[model samples]
Target: MAAHMKEQTVKVKTRPDYSKQLITDIRWLLWAVTIGGLLLAAYCIHNGYVGSLPWLSAMVGLPWTAHGVVCSFYLNMAKSDHKEGGITFESAKANSFVADETNTEGPMG
Candidate 1:
Protein backbone atom coordinates (compact mmCIF):
# COMPACT_ATOMS: atom_id res chain seq x y z
CA MET A 1 0.00 0.00 0.00
CA ALA A 2 2.85 2.44 0.78
CA ALA A 3 4.67 1.59 -2.48
CA HIS A 4 1.47 2.10 -4.41
CA MET A 5 0.90 5.47 -2.77
CA LYS A 6 4.48 6.63 -3.66
CA GLU A 7 4.05 5.57 -7.25
CA GLN A 8 0.81 7.49 -7.52
CA THR A 9 2.47 10.62 -6.08
CA VAL A 10 5.23 10.64 -8.73
CA LYS A 11 4.66 12.80 -11.80
CA VAL A 12 5.82 12.16 -15.35
CA LYS A 13 6.76 14.99 -17.75
CA THR A 14 6.56 14.48 -21.52
CA ARG A 15 7.27 17.87 -23.11
CA PRO A 16 8.52 17.47 -26.68
CA ASP A 17 10.66 20.13 -28.39
CA TYR A 18 9.03 20.26 -31.82
CA SER A 19 11.29 23.04 -33.17
CA LYS A 20 14.17 20.64 -33.79
CA GLN A 21 11.78 18.09 -35.23
CA LEU A 22 10.56 20.57 -37.85
CA ILE A 23 14.13 21.46 -38.77
CA THR A 24 15.08 17.82 -39.16
CA ASP A 25 12.03 17.15 -41.34
CA ILE A 26 12.85 20.13 -43.60
CA ARG A 27 16.49 19.04 -43.86
CA TRP A 28 15.48 15.55 -44.97
CA LEU A 29 13.15 17.05 -47.59
CA LEU A 30 15.95 19.31 -48.83
CA TRP A 31 18.23 16.27 -49.16
CA ALA A 32 15.51 14.46 -51.08
CA VAL A 33 15.11 17.36 -53.53
CA THR A 34 18.87 17.58 -54.03
CA ILE A 35 19.25 13.86 -54.67
CA GLY A 36 16.25 13.81 -57.02
CA GLY A 37 17.56 16.84 -58.93
CA LEU A 38 21.00 15.26 -59.35
CA LEU A 39 19.47 12.02 -60.60
CA LEU A 40 17.35 13.94 -63.08
CA ALA A 41 20.36 15.90 -64.32
CA ALA A 42 22.33 12.71 -64.80
CA TYR A 43 19.49 11.06 -66.69
CA CYS A 44 19.07 14.14 -68.89
CA ILE A 45 22.77 14.20 -69.78
CA HIS A 46 23.11 10.49 -70.44
CA ASN A 47 19.90 9.91 -72.40
CA GLY A 48 19.12 13.36 -73.85
CA TYR A 49 15.72 15.05 -73.64
CA VAL A 50 14.04 12.74 -76.17
CA GLY A 51 14.71 9.63 -74.09
CA SER A 52 14.54 11.25 -70.64
CA LEU A 53 10.79 11.19 -70.12
CA PRO A 54 11.05 9.49 -66.73
CA TRP A 55 13.71 11.94 -65.56
CA LEU A 56 11.59 14.83 -66.84
CA SER A 57 8.72 13.57 -64.78
CA ALA A 58 10.91 13.39 -61.68
CA MET A 59 12.19 16.90 -62.31
CA VAL A 60 8.64 18.20 -62.58
CA GLY A 61 7.79 16.54 -59.28
CA LEU A 62 10.78 18.05 -57.44
CA PRO A 63 9.29 21.55 -57.05
CA TRP A 64 6.16 20.09 -55.55
CA THR A 65 8.31 18.19 -53.06
CA ALA A 66 9.88 21.40 -51.81
CA HIS A 67 6.52 23.13 -51.65
CA GLY A 68 4.97 20.29 -49.69
CA VAL A 69 7.90 20.15 -47.28
CA VAL A 70 7.70 23.86 -46.51
CA CYS A 71 3.96 23.74 -46.19
CA SER A 72 4.12 20.84 -43.76
CA PHE A 73 6.84 22.54 -41.73
CA TYR A 74 4.67 25.63 -41.40
CA LEU A 75 1.66 23.54 -40.47
CA ASN A 76 3.57 21.72 -37.76
CA MET A 77 4.99 24.89 -36.30
CA ALA A 78 1.61 26.58 -36.40
CA LYS A 79 -0.10 23.68 -34.68
CA SER A 80 2.55 23.66 -31.93
CA ASP A 81 1.06 26.86 -30.53
CA HIS A 82 -1.50 25.97 -27.84
CA LYS A 83 -2.60 29.50 -26.95
CA GLU A 84 -5.42 29.76 -29.47
CA GLY A 85 -7.22 26.62 -28.29
CA GLY A 86 -7.86 25.50 -31.88
CA ILE A 87 -9.81 27.12 -34.71
CA THR A 88 -13.14 28.82 -33.89
CA PHE A 89 -16.40 28.02 -35.61
CA GLU A 90 -17.06 31.67 -36.41
CA SER A 91 -13.79 32.01 -38.27
CA ALA A 92 -14.46 28.84 -40.19
CA LYS A 93 -17.96 29.91 -41.09
CA ALA A 94 -16.77 33.38 -42.09
CA ASN A 95 -14.06 31.98 -44.32
CA SER A 96 -16.43 29.38 -45.80
CA PHE A 97 -19.73 31.00 -46.88
CA VAL A 98 -21.65 28.56 -49.02
CA ALA A 99 -25.33 28.39 -49.83
CA ASP A 100 -27.63 26.89 -47.22
CA GLU A 101 -29.46 23.62 -47.85
CA THR A 102 -32.22 23.69 -50.52
CA ASN A 103 -34.68 21.19 -51.88
CA THR A 104 -33.95 19.61 -55.26
CA GLU A 105 -37.36 20.78 -56.52
CA GLY A 106 -38.28 24.46 -56.76
CA PRO A 107 -38.57 26.38 -53.43
CA MET A 108 -42.36 26.83 -53.93
CA GLY A 109 -42.82 23.15 -54.61
Candidate 2:
Protein backbone atom coordinates (compact mmCIF):
# COMPACT_ATOMS: atom_id res chain seq x y z
CA MET A 1 0.00 0.00 0.00
CA ALA A 2 1.20 3.60 -0.77
CA ALA A 3 1.50 6.24 1.99
CA HIS A 4 -0.78 9.31 1.85
CA MET A 5 0.78 12.76 1.79
CA LYS A 6 -0.75 16.02 2.95
CA GLU A 7 -0.47 19.35 1.10
CA GLN A 8 -0.58 22.85 2.61
CA THR A 9 -1.08 26.33 1.15
CA VAL A 10 0.53 29.55 2.28
CA LYS A 11 -1.21 32.91 2.29
CA VAL A 12 0.44 36.09 1.09
CA LYS A 13 -0.19 39.57 2.44
CA THR A 14 -1.03 42.52 0.26
CA ARG A 15 0.14 46.09 0.91
CA PRO A 16 -2.54 48.59 1.87
CA ASP A 17 -3.48 51.24 -0.66
CA TYR A 18 -1.79 54.56 0.20
CA SER A 19 -2.62 56.59 -2.89
CA LYS A 20 -5.38 58.51 -1.11
CA GLN A 21 -3.15 59.37 1.81
CA LEU A 22 -0.32 60.43 -0.50
CA ILE A 23 -2.60 62.68 -2.51
CA THR A 24 -3.95 64.26 0.66
CA ASP A 25 -0.43 64.99 1.84
CA ILE A 26 0.45 66.48 -1.52
CA ARG A 27 -2.65 68.69 -1.42
CA TRP A 28 -1.76 70.02 2.05
CA LEU A 29 1.84 70.71 1.02
CA LEU A 30 0.72 72.58 -2.10
CA TRP A 31 -1.73 74.70 -0.10
CA ALA A 32 0.95 75.54 2.46
CA VAL A 33 3.47 76.59 -0.21
CA THR A 34 0.91 78.68 -2.09
CA ILE A 35 -0.28 80.50 1.03
CA GLY A 36 3.27 81.03 2.30
CA GLY A 37 4.40 82.31 -1.08
CA LEU A 38 1.52 84.80 -1.20
CA LEU A 39 2.39 86.13 2.29
CA LEU A 40 6.07 86.44 1.36
CA ALA A 41 5.20 88.23 -1.87
CA ALA A 42 2.98 90.67 0.04
CA TYR A 43 5.78 91.35 2.51
CA CYS A 44 8.26 91.99 -0.28
CA ILE A 45 5.86 94.38 -2.02
CA HIS A 46 5.23 96.26 1.22
CA ASN A 47 8.97 96.81 1.74
CA GLY A 48 9.45 97.87 -1.88
CA TYR A 49 11.42 94.78 -2.83
CA VAL A 50 9.34 94.54 -6.02
CA GLY A 51 12.32 93.14 -7.88
CA SER A 52 11.41 89.65 -6.52
CA LEU A 53 7.75 89.86 -7.54
CA PRO A 54 8.27 87.82 -10.67
CA TRP A 55 10.09 85.09 -8.77
CA LEU A 56 7.40 85.11 -6.10
CA SER A 57 4.71 84.79 -8.72
CA ALA A 58 6.47 81.79 -10.20
CA MET A 59 6.74 80.25 -6.75
CA VAL A 60 3.01 80.67 -6.17
CA GLY A 61 2.18 79.36 -9.63
CA LEU A 62 4.19 76.20 -9.08
CA PRO A 63 1.46 74.61 -6.94
CA TRP A 64 -1.22 75.23 -9.58
CA THR A 65 1.01 73.73 -12.24
CA ALA A 66 1.62 70.70 -10.01
CA HIS A 67 -2.16 70.38 -9.46
CA GLY A 68 -2.74 70.28 -13.20
CA VAL A 69 -0.14 67.57 -13.60
CA VAL A 70 -1.68 65.59 -10.76
CA CYS A 71 -5.11 65.90 -12.40
CA SER A 72 -3.76 64.58 -15.69
CA PHE A 73 -2.22 61.61 -13.89
CA TYR A 74 -5.54 60.90 -12.14
CA LEU A 75 -7.36 61.02 -15.47
CA ASN A 76 -4.94 58.56 -16.95
CA MET A 77 -5.28 56.28 -13.91
CA ALA A 78 -9.07 56.35 -14.20
CA LYS A 79 -8.86 55.43 -17.86
CA SER A 80 -6.59 52.51 -17.15
CA ASP A 81 -8.77 51.35 -14.28
CA HIS A 82 -11.86 51.43 -16.51
CA LYS A 83 -10.03 49.36 -19.11
CA GLU A 84 -9.19 46.82 -16.40
CA GLY A 85 -12.92 46.39 -15.58
CA GLY A 86 -12.70 48.44 -12.40
CA ILE A 87 -15.86 50.28 -11.30
CA THR A 88 -15.09 53.95 -11.89
CA PHE A 89 -17.35 56.94 -12.50
CA GLU A 90 -16.75 56.69 -16.24
CA SER A 91 -17.60 53.00 -16.18
CA ALA A 92 -20.80 53.65 -14.24
CA LYS A 93 -21.89 56.28 -16.77
CA ALA A 94 -21.02 53.99 -19.66
CA ASN A 95 -23.07 51.14 -18.18
CA SER A 96 -26.08 53.33 -17.44
CA PHE A 97 -28.88 53.56 -20.00
CA VAL A 98 -29.62 57.06 -21.16
CA ALA A 99 -32.03 58.11 -23.91
CA ASP A 100 -30.14 60.18 -26.43
CA GLU A 101 -30.43 61.13 -30.07
CA THR A 102 -28.05 58.35 -31.04
CA ASN A 103 -29.96 55.76 -29.01
CA THR A 104 -33.63 56.48 -29.48
CA GLU A 105 -34.91 53.65 -27.27
CA GLY A 106 -32.00 53.38 -24.87
CA PRO A 107 -30.09 50.14 -23.91
CA MET A 108 -33.17 48.00 -23.40
CA GLY A 109 -34.19 48.50 -26.97
Candidate 3:
Protein backbone atom coordinates (compact mmCIF):
# COMPACT_ATOMS: atom_id res chain seq x y z
CA MET A 1 0.00 0.00 0.00
CA ALA A 2 1.16 3.64 -0.61
CA ALA A 3 0.47 4.61 3.03
CA HIS A 4 2.67 1.75 4.31
CA MET A 5 5.50 2.68 1.95
CA LYS A 6 5.43 6.34 3.08
CA GLU A 7 5.50 5.46 6.81
CA GLN A 8 9.25 4.86 7.09
CA THR A 9 10.99 6.13 10.21
CA VAL A 10 13.02 9.34 9.99
CA LYS A 11 16.00 10.54 12.10
CA VAL A 12 16.35 14.26 12.68
CA LYS A 13 19.85 15.85 12.67
CA THR A 14 21.10 18.68 14.88
CA ARG A 15 21.66 22.26 13.69
CA PRO A 16 24.94 23.36 12.10
CA ASP A 17 27.75 25.06 14.04
CA TYR A 18 28.23 28.86 14.31
CA SER A 19 32.01 29.34 14.52
CA LYS A 20 32.01 30.53 10.94
CA GLN A 21 29.51 33.23 11.87
CA LEU A 22 31.82 34.45 14.63
CA ILE A 23 34.75 34.81 12.20
CA THR A 24 32.49 36.56 9.68
CA ASP A 25 31.40 39.05 12.34
CA ILE A 26 35.01 39.76 13.27
CA ARG A 27 35.95 40.35 9.63
CA TRP A 28 32.97 42.64 9.05
CA LEU A 29 33.85 44.76 12.12
CA LEU A 30 37.49 45.06 11.04
CA TRP A 31 36.54 46.23 7.55
CA ALA A 32 33.98 48.69 8.96
CA VAL A 33 36.66 50.23 11.21
CA THR A 34 39.20 50.40 8.38
CA ILE A 35 36.76 52.13 6.06
CA GLY A 36 35.64 54.53 8.79
CA GLY A 37 39.20 55.58 9.62
CA LEU A 38 40.09 56.11 5.98
CA LEU A 39 36.96 58.23 5.53
CA LEU A 40 37.85 60.41 8.52
CA ALA A 41 41.38 60.92 7.21
CA ALA A 42 40.07 61.89 3.81
CA TYR A 43 37.64 64.37 5.37
CA CYS A 44 40.42 66.02 7.36
CA ILE A 45 42.59 66.36 4.30
CA HIS A 46 39.78 67.76 2.19
CA ASN A 47 38.89 70.47 4.73
CA GLY A 48 42.50 71.51 5.14
CA TYR A 49 42.40 70.69 8.84
CA VAL A 50 46.07 69.69 8.63
CA GLY A 51 47.18 73.25 7.72
CA SER A 52 46.99 74.51 11.30
CA LEU A 53 47.59 71.18 13.06
CA PRO A 54 50.12 68.77 11.54
CA TRP A 55 50.47 65.95 14.06
CA LEU A 56 46.86 65.99 15.26
CA SER A 57 45.45 64.36 12.14
CA ALA A 58 48.16 61.75 12.11
CA MET A 59 47.71 61.04 15.82
CA VAL A 60 44.05 60.17 15.49
CA GLY A 61 43.99 58.60 12.04
CA LEU A 62 47.28 56.68 12.08
CA PRO A 63 46.68 54.58 15.19
CA TRP A 64 43.04 53.75 14.33
CA THR A 65 44.04 52.73 10.80
CA ALA A 66 46.91 50.61 12.14
CA HIS A 67 44.60 48.93 14.66
CA GLY A 68 42.13 48.21 11.85
CA VAL A 69 44.90 46.57 9.84
CA VAL A 70 45.90 44.40 12.77
CA CYS A 71 42.28 43.38 13.35
CA SER A 72 42.00 42.45 9.67
CA PHE A 73 45.05 40.19 9.96
CA TYR A 74 43.56 38.48 13.02
CA LEU A 75 40.28 38.01 11.12
CA ASN A 76 42.16 36.32 8.27
CA MET A 77 43.87 33.97 10.72
CA ALA A 78 40.60 33.11 12.40
CA LYS A 79 39.01 32.33 9.03
CA SER A 80 41.65 29.68 8.17
CA ASP A 81 40.36 27.16 10.69
CA HIS A 82 37.11 25.71 11.99
CA LYS A 83 36.83 25.03 15.72
CA GLU A 84 35.44 21.76 16.99
CA GLY A 85 33.01 21.45 19.87
CA GLY A 86 34.63 20.24 23.07
CA ILE A 87 33.25 18.33 26.05
CA THR A 88 30.17 19.71 27.69
CA PHE A 89 30.04 20.52 31.40
CA GLU A 90 27.15 19.26 33.46
CA SER A 91 27.23 22.18 35.89
CA ALA A 92 29.22 25.28 36.86
CA LYS A 93 30.78 23.58 39.90
CA ALA A 94 32.01 20.66 37.79
CA ASN A 95 35.42 22.30 37.16
CA SER A 96 35.49 25.20 39.57
CA PHE A 97 39.02 24.88 40.89
CA VAL A 98 42.41 24.92 39.19
CA ALA A 99 44.65 21.85 39.62
CA ASP A 100 47.79 23.94 40.23
CA GLU A 101 47.92 26.78 42.78
CA THR A 102 51.45 28.23 42.69
CA ASN A 103 51.16 31.96 43.20
CA THR A 104 54.57 33.63 43.41
CA GLU A 105 55.71 37.22 43.92
CA GLY A 106 57.88 39.65 41.82
CA PRO A 107 59.72 39.03 38.54
CA MET A 108 62.91 37.48 40.02
CA GLY A 109 62.12 37.25 43.71
The lDDT of each candidate is 0.57, 0.66, 0.52
lDDT tens digits, residue span 17-109, model 1: 465455556677767876778777777787766654665556657666766877686666556442344443344365574543332322112
Winner by TM-score between candidate 3 and candidate 2: 2
Indicate the worst ten consecutive residues by lDDT in candidate 2.
Answer: 100-109
Write model 2 residue lDDT over 15-93, tens digit each, in one string: 3236545566778888998999989988887888846377777887877798778868866775676664666545557
Error of 2 at 72 (Å): 1.2
lDDT of 1 at 49: 62
**For each candidate, what TM-score against the reference?**
0.33, 0.56, 0.35
Clashes of each: 0, 0, 0
Better of 1 and 2 by TM-score: 2
lDDT of 3 by residue, 1-109 (tens): 5865776554444333354444456567666766766677688889887565545556556655866676576555544432322222222134553332233222212
Q: Between candidates 2 and 3, which one is better according to lDDT?
A: 2
What C-alpha lDDT, on a 0 to 100 scale, does residue 5 get in candidate 2? 56
Candidate 3 clashing pairs, residues 3+ apart or interchain: none
Runs off by more than 4 Å, candidate 1: 1-16, 19-23, 47-49, 54-56, 59-63, 66-82, 86-109
Candidate 1 — what's its lDDT?
0.57
Better of 1 and 3 by lDDT: 1
Q: Which pairs of residues have clashing backbones in candidate 2?
A: none
